[model samples]
Target: MGDENVDEIIKDFILLQDDIVIDRYSNGGANGELYFGERKLLSDRVALKFYYYNKDVSTHNEPLILKSIEHPNILKIYDAKIIHQQYAYFLTPEISGGDLKNFKDNNIVSFYDAINITQGILNGLSELHKNPNNLLHRDLKPKNILIDQETKTPYIADFGSVKFISNAENSVVASKSTQIYRPNESVVQNVYNRQSDIYQVGIIFFQLLGGKFPEAPFEWLDDRQKSKFLKISGSEFEKWQFIDSAIDNLIVKNKLLDYDSLPAYINNKVKAVIKTATNKDLNKRYFTCSEFIKDLFDLKKQNKDWRIDNQEIYANKENKKYYRISEDKKGYCLQVSKNQVNWTKDNKHDGTLESIISRIHKD
Candidate 1:
C-alpha cells in the first residue's frame, strides 16, 4: 500500500517491452484475491502473480533467484517488482494448459502422458542441479507447475521458498517469506542440497500418479517422519541434520504399496525411477538432478519401439541432438547415436559392448 512500492511495480511494468496490463482475477489462487495481468514484465504473454504484502518477505528473493536461472523446461522470469511492498513476478510463457493436479481430479491422465510430465520436470531439475551457485527448489508441487495446453509443456513456477546454496542473503527480521513453504515439523535442519530437491520431485511424481498426498497410505510412519512428509514430504525440511537423516532412512522401510493397483500406464520402468528418487534414504537415491535425468532416458527406452536395422527419423541436421525412434519394442534397449557426442563412447572404445556394461553376472 506504500506509494514508493506502487511506483516500483508500475515502472518495472512500463519498462517491459511487452508492457503488461494489470488486472486482478478473483479466481485461481486460494491466497488473497488472485490477480491477473497480461503482457507481464517477465514475458510477452505471461501474467503477474501478486500476493498482498503479508509479514513474510523471504519470498521477495524468489523473483531475484528465478531471473538468474534459464532452461527450456523452467518457467522464464521476466521481471520482479513490488506492488505496495508486496512482491510480484512476471513470467514469459502463458500457462493455459492447466496443472497436473487439475487433470487428476477431473480424469485419469494416460500413463504415457504422466511419463512425459515426469520427464520434463526431470530435465528442468537436471539443469538447475548443475548450477554452481547451488539452487534448491524447496517447494515443488502440482500447483507450482504451470502447463501449456498446446504443447502440453509444463513449466516449474513459484520460487517463493527457494533456498540458495549459501546465503542469509534474502533473510531479514522484518518480513521473511519462509513460513508459507518452509515447514517447522522436521527433525533435520534445512540446508540446500541436491538430494533435498530430488525428494520434492518424488512428491510431485507421487501426487500426479496417485492424485493426492499419500498421507493415509503412509500414516503408519512415526510422528516425526509423518509430520515431516505431511508438511513438505521430505527430510529437506528437517530441523537438525544428523538426526533427520537417520529418521528419514528408517521411515522408507521399503513399504512401496499397491504397485499392482496402479493404472496400466504406470509402467515398471517409470515406477523404479520415481521410487528411487523418492526413497526415504538419500544415500540409496539419485544424488543429483542430472542423475535423475539420465535414469529417465534409460527408463523411456524401455517402452519405446526402436529397431537397429530401420530406425525412424531421429535427427535433423541443424539440431545437434538426436533420438532413437521408438513405438514399442516391448523390452529393454540400448540406443547409441551416430554423431560425435559420447560419454559412453570414451568410456567404452568405439561402439563395442566391452566399454559398456560387461556380460551379466552369473550370481
Candidate 2:
C-alpha cells in the first residue's frame, strides 16, 4: 500500500469518529501507523494506533489483551473500534518519552536506570504470566517498551503478538517475532511460551546494559565473519537479506549465545543472571517472571552504588584499557583510562559506538 492510500484510511477513520481528532503523524511500522490524537470529550491527547486489516499481521487481539491486563507498567488502552473490518484503531494515553530504542541510542543508560527499566518490564510481564491471564508477550523488544518522559518509567507497550497459554492445546500459531530476538527453541521448534518470553526479555536486558543487541546463537562467530557482515557493500534491503541468510546458517549449526561482548564494568552477578535468563537450554532459564525479578532485587542489594559512577565506560579486553563514550553537541566523545578513574580524551575517535570500539584496540 502507498502512503496516500494509508492516509485515506486515516481520513475515513476520522470521518467515523465524532470526538477523536488526529493531530499529526507520529511514526509507523510494518503493521500500522501511530498518530498524536485528541479526545475532545476528555480533553486529553492520546496515542492513536491504526492497524490496517492484513492476514500477515495479527493485531485484532491487541485491544482485548490490553484491556485484560491493566497495569501501571503496561500501556493503558482507552478505547477501540473496528471500522468496517478494514481498519482497527485504538487510543492510548500518549507516552512522551518515546520508545526504549530511541531512548537508549540517544542517552547513556546508567546501571540504575537499566535495572529499574528491566524490573518495570518484568512487573508488567508478571501480570501476563500469572493465573487468570496465562498470557505470553510473544514479542518483547526495545521498540515495544515505551518510556515516560516525566517519570522515566518504562511501560510495556505492543501486544499484537500475545498468546494465551491456556489455549495452547486447542490452538497453535506460528511465531512472528523478529528473528534476532527469538529464542533458539522458537526459531527451531516453533515454541512460544513463558521461557521464550524470558529469552527475548534477556536480549533487551543485555541491550539495556551494553547498548548493543546481542546476536544470540550466532554471537560466537569469529571476528572475520563479523567484519564481513559489517563491511557488506549494498543497499539496506540487500544488507538485510545477507543478514537473514547469516542467521539462517547459524540456526542450522545450532549455536548458542555468548557473553564475550558484554563490557567488563558489568559485574559477574549481573552477567550470571542474564546468562541464566537467556540460556539456550530451557531447563536453565528462569522458570517465571517472579524468579527473574527476585534475582534482580538481590543484585541491587549486593551492589547498592555500583562502584563506577560513570555510565559510559566500556572495556576492550584486547588492549586491557577502559574507554568511555559521551555525547556532546558536536558528536560522541571518546576517552580512555588505564584504570577506571583518570581519563584522557581520544580526539580522533569521536563517532558511532561501533566506530569508536573498532579503533579502541589500535590506540
Candidate 3:
C-alpha cells in the first residue's frame, strides 16, 4: 500500500479509538503494521499493531495469547479491538530501544549485559512454557525480542507463530519465517515439541554470546537450502545430492574443535550448557527452560568478572578499532586495526569476533 493510504488508515483508526497516533512504525510481515500511539485518557505511550482482516489463524489469536500471558519479560497487551470487522488492532507498551537485532548491531554489549539480556529472554520463555495455555513461541528470533530503552531489559514479543499444545490433537504448523531456528527433530522427523523451542533458545544464546549464529563447518548450504532439505523426511534425505557426504564432513569437522574450541571467555561449564541446549538429540537436550536457566546462572556465578574489555572493541565497528591478540618476542601483544585476528596455536581464529562483526555491518 502507498504511504498516503497507510496514513489515512491510521488517521481513521485514531478517530475510531481514544488513542492519538504519534507515528506509524514499519510494516510487518503477514499484513500487519505497527504504530506508536498514546491513550487519550491516560496519555500512556503504546505500540499499536494493526492487521487487515485476514484468514491467518495467528492474526486472530495473537491478542488472545498476549492477554493470557502475564510476565514482566513478556510484552503486555493493554487492549484489543476489531473495527467494523475490517481491521484488528492491539496496544502494547511502546519500547523505544528497538529489537534485539538493532541493539546487537548498534551497541557493544558487554558479556554481563549479554547475560542479563539473555536471562531476561529465558525468564520470559520459561513463563510461556509453564503457562496453562501451553504456548510455544514458534517464532523466537532476535527481531522478535524487544528491548526497553530505560532499563535495557529484554521482552519477548510477536506471537504471530505461537502454537498451543495443551490439546492432544495439537499439531505443528509450518512457517517459512522460522525455518532457520527449527530443531533437527522438527526438520527430520516432523516432530516439534517444547524441546524445539529450547533448541531455538540455545541458538539465540549462542548469538548473544558470540554476536553471530553458530555455523558448523558442515553446513555448506545457506538457510534457504537447509529449509528445503528440512522439508524432506530423514529416510529420503540420503537420496538428495551428496547428503551422506555432507553429514560425513560435518562429523569429521566437529571432532576438530568441538564445543571446547569456544573462546577463553566461555569456560568449559558454559560450553557444556550450550552443547546440551543445542544438542541434535532431543533426549539429551534440556527438557525445560528452567533447567537451562539454572545452568546459565551457575555459569554466571562462577565468573566474578564476566566482562571482557578487549571484546568491546570488536563490536564497535564505527570506531574502526580492530585488534588481534598475539604472542611476540616479549609476550602476548595486541595488533590494532587488523582485517582479521591471528590464528591461535590450534590454527583456529575467533570466528565470532572476526566474522560476526563483518556480517553485521554487511547486513
* Candidate number with greatest lDDT: 2
Ranking by TM-score: 2, 3, 1
Least accurate stretch of 10 residues (summed lDDT) in model 3?
A: 248-257
Candidate 2 matches the true fold with a TM-score of 0.73
Instruction: Sort the predicted structures by lDDT, highest score first.
Output: 2, 3, 1
Q: Judged by TM-score, which candidate is best?
A: 2
Model 2 segments beyond 4 Å from truth? 1-5, 15-21, 53-59, 167-174, 214-242, 248-258, 304-363
For each candidate in turn, the TM-score is 0.57, 0.73, 0.70
What lDDT tens digits, residue by residue, belong to model 2 across residues 1-363? 233556676766665767867667755543678777678889887887888765556657887788877898999998887764578787889887789888877766766677788899999998888888888888899889999876779998888788787844522354766887777777667777787788778878888887345545345345776787678788888766766666755543434344666664566788889988887788889988889989988876554222123655454433356667767777677887778689898876547655665565345
lDDT, candidate 3, 284-357, per-residue tens: 89998888888877766554323334434322233344434444554434344434454222223344444433
Q: Looking at model 2, which ten-residue stretch has the lowest summed lDDT?
A: 304-313
For model 1, what is the C-alpha lDDT against the true structure?
0.52
User: Please, what are the lDDT tens digits per residue for candidate 1 over residues 1-363?
Assistant: 122334345445444534556443434543322334565354445555555554474545655666777877888866655555554544444577656566555644433456567778877876665646556666676776877766667788776655555443422111122222222212134433567567667757655655334433344345776666556634644434433443344434444334554533345666788778766566777877767767766755554321122332121122343233223343222234546265121222233322221211000
